[model samples]
Target: MTLDERAARRRYATVSALFWLPLGLSIAPLVLLLTERGMAMTAVAGFFAAHSLTTAALELPTGGLSDVIGRRNVLAAAGLLNLAALTLLGLGTTPVLLGLGMALMGAARALSSGPAEAWYVDTVHAHAGPDAELRTGLARGATATDAALAVGTLTGGALPWLIGLAPELGARLGEATSGLVLPLSVPLLLGAAVEIAFVSYALSALPEPPRPPTPLRHVLRDVPATVAGGLRLGGRDALVRRVLVSAGAAGSALATAELLTPGRAADLTGAPESGAVLFAALACAGFACAAVGAHLAPLTARRTGGGERAIAASLTTSAAGLLLLGVTTALPGAFALALAAVGYGLVYLGLGATGPNENDLLHRRVSSTGRATALSVQSLALQLTAALTGLIVTVLPPGPLPWSLAGAALLAGALLWARGGSESRPYAIPDATGGPDATAERRPGHGRPLGGRTGARE
Candidate 1:
């Protein structure tokens, strides 16, 4: 790799780490915090659904916005939005206010989704040429993201308990604030501070590539065309369509794990506060496992004979983990908690492994101009399916059933890429003559080769 390419990779990994850390800090305790504020489980589900719905509604638009405006600008905007949203989440007591906060958070998530990665891809391709290797850098960024989450989850989980230990401090702070301040809110407020850092860093660290100048009117006119073109790719390209479906299945698996795991942790611990700590530890462990899986992706792909096959195997492993979680719901004591933790960790590991492999394929199918939009489309599918899955799981009685259903869905998704043959090889776009083409073929002889040149046109 060139020096410029190495610098770009470092920047990408830094952005990935920064982007995920605050979110990890907030995620482990969010449900418990809301419930502590007097929300019932159903109400909590509604809040989650609201967040998902908002993200889904805005995903495509924000993706196009990134393509229209500069990626750095859109990322900065997302960080600013997250600052407001986290503040509201930390301070608000009423459901309406909190719901608004959740909606804003979703908007932030949508805006942030593809810009950083898009910037990295665009930058690397510009510096290193289209056929430059991408998987190694991409995988490194993924590992960095998971590592941030692991650290943040561990610290966030412990913050509330640490705060509670200082009775005199807590009492004085409580009195000064008229009891609005609480131990549980500290981590979220800290997360808000992190957003400030994120916004500043994004503006300073990410450079925008030169493109055709887009005025407000031009953006308004052209963004829809870009979005439509991106949407059309899913139907026009068989590989992109399958990738979308796989994203949806992955979303379902994620929704099931996030929704049910905290409750299970609480049940094991017999208290919400303790549950937060336990869940945080579990989340940290899961993210650690995810990092390992992401780091091992290249090797896994080579061993499995292709990226598609690796994805299939990873998804199947995730399904089995979910199945284990479902089946062990009735087990007693520490054993069950241990089993659940393993299951949870495995799911994250599988997801970590699956993501880069799938994205590498998707990147091969689209041009740079539409890359962010294509990623948004994939995210839209995931969020939409997750929102639906959340609703369905909410009404079902807690047990093995919801998890089993999720596992089944993941298994079905795996089957989409399970077939062995030339299809498992790195995908090549058809040539103008409509014959087999090798212009953008993956590096020869490896099913899941890392760092091959990207074929997407600008």
Candidate 2:
């Protein structure tokens, strides 16, 4: 059955919430549970590395699978994988089992990266046509996702502490469960249960047009070809490339902040325990600010005249925030601390605003056939850049240098889009009439279009 624009947006928001809440629940407890199970800090880091590598490896392949097979199926598979991963992580004592669980979790993350958003865009286009308003719905979905995350984080952290208050009851429960159920394990186990609901809801709510059946061999062949096409999209489309590079820049900024914030907090508070608490509070605040920014994305676009300009403005704001953080690092006292908090919130807010606008522009350029793959390519760019930036930030001498480096990267990204929204033109794409449609004229010497004659409009 076809869905109207409103119904599509509602379902997208719901799916996004369901998909991310479980992750937020686990974020507070996963590392603690691992260390509690006798793994050292180095081993815990290794497990995290495993997760990252697995996710990076599978991102494009799973994305192409969604493009070829369908969104609903891939999303269901992701939920199922996450369920198993969470279960194993919660109860397993052996390092092998824990590592495998982390790997599976990463695989689930890769599979889930693009299908929900792709489905939302496809459904809206199916009902409302290509030019339908998407930024509002996309903004709503992002807001829901961040809201769920913030709520889940608070609940997750509270559960274990609340359980700790009644030591006898906690001991009794642990004894009854044969050492398998601990207070720290509660969040992961709860997340596993949420996955069941997520899978069921996705199956019932996310209807799609039927895809033609294909042989297994054909499926394998098409996936790689689609991934290659997705990679080539960046080379041919300048705006898409800008989106990708900007994502990397954002990733760099994010990595720098995440890597440095805890130590800085500890320095201010004079204790790691107090710093962890402060960081947790800051995380929740960051998520809340992100939700607010997402809610304002459509209005930002309207005021700025287009998505491209909105992105430029948002990134510039974020760069300014980072620079503020760098400047505050040199100052001392509670006033500097307050300023740093504002800068931190600004970073998340600007990044949140950038997301919906960037994706709106991206969706308008690519067809449904490669939509998920294109998103996967964008995610891969972010992940790879963040990982690299994490290493680079560590090696640099501590203080404002790292923050300055990240700010410069973000500013460069903003500059790429400073050419104004008038230059924001749709490139050539295959139209219903089976010929290239030059929806907008191409500027001179901006580079040639792919698979089209030279001097042709793109």
Candidate 3:
């Protein structure tokens, strides 16, 4: 890789880590705080349910906006809005306030999602290469996000008590705004710093791909047609479609588990009051392990071969973890939770690693305007799946819900990804068979051999 390619990848990775940090940071304490503050648990679930639906509702429009207006602009707006939402969460003690806060957060999330990826891809594409380097940065950044969530959750959970135990570390935090502001304030600060970094990176590192800047008036006229084209093509593009559907199903299951795990653990351990804290810590630990697993993705691929095999293996492991959780009668369920988390993180790596190439393939079938719309359809579908999964969780015994998702992901996901045809590309770090030869060669993922070095060779 050229110096520019390497630098762009690094910049993109940093952006990924920063963007994901807020999601987990907010999630770690959200449930416990909401419930403790007198909101019903079911209502809490409703907040996310609404959140998922609203995000899907907005995904297409925002994605189009990115195409029309430029990703950097949309992303900066997302960051500012995100900070506003987090601040609202800190002050909220009622359902309406909480709901509003969550709604804003959802809006921020929808705005932030695709544009960042698009920006990175466009940047890499402009810099005398293909989409591969961009994808590598994405995966690396995703790993960083996972690690940050792990750190945030662990720290957030323990900080209050630690403050009590050792006053020095948190003395000023307590003095300035008491404990509440400190916990939430930190995430906002990190988010702002990262958001500025993203904007700066966009300005400095990413070269403008030779493509013409889109005109806003023209984009308004064109987006509908572009969206229609993406829908029609995505319907026929079996690989992309399958991946979309699979991600949604897996998302629903993951959502269910995310919603329930802390509650279940809280009940079992008599930590209902502080369950969020413990859950965050444990969840982060599991997520951290998963990030390690993600770092190992290239190595895993070398050993497993390309295609749906490694993904299938991850799903099966998830199923086993789910089953263990369902059947276990005691604290061993903690182990089950860990297993489920491990499975969850790897599944993300397997699937997310595939996302850019899928986009590249879809891009071949459509224009830049159409690319944004196609991405939107995928996002819309995933959100729909998550909302539906809410209904499933409302009924299923919590433990069984995770198992159900695991089984569906393994059995159904495999069938879906494999439905299109045999992969013509080498199932390696950068799967390039689906796009043009030049694009494939420029792809820059580090290999993750099963039980071997990753990026270490670099």
Between prediction 1 and prediction 2, which has the larger TM-score?
2
Candidate 3 residue 207 Cα shift, in angstroms, is 4.2
lDDT tens readout by residue for model 1, 1-458: 22367788788888888888888888766877898889899988889778878998899988888877879899999988888988888888999988988999999999998888888878877786766666667777788999999988887778887878888887887788887777777778888899888888888887775567778898997678768867877877787888999999999999999888888889888898788678777878889988987876766676787778888998998998999899778898989888888899889899888887787677666666677888899999998898799889878999999999999999998999897444445655422112233135654443335433322111
Q: Candidate 2 lDDT, tens digit per residue, 1-458? A: 99987888899999999988988888778888999999999999999999999999999999999988999999999999999999999999989999999999999999999999999999988997765667778888899998988888877888898999999978997999999888999988999999999999999999999889989999998898888888888887777889999999999989988888888777667789988887878777888888888888877876776677888889988888888888877888787788888988989899989999888878776778888988999999999999999999999987889999999999999898777553344355321111244243434322211121211211
Model 3, runs deviating above 4 Å: 1-3, 32-50, 91-98, 128-135, 164-216, 267-278, 329-369, 398-402, 418-421, 425-458
Model 1 spans > 4 angstroms off: 1-3, 35-45, 175-180, 266-277, 420-458
**What TM-score against the true fold does each predicted structure earn?**
0.88, 0.93, 0.77
lDDT scores for all predictions? 0.81, 0.85, 0.57
* lDDT top scorer: 2
Model 2 TM-score is 0.93
Best by TM-score: 2
> What does the lDDT come to for candidate 1?
0.81
lDDT of 3: 0.57
lDDT of 1 at 104: 91
In model 1, residue pairs whose N, Cα or C atoms come closer than 3 Å (at least 3 residues apart or on different chains), thus clashing, are 131-453, 132-453, 133-451, 134-451, 306-447
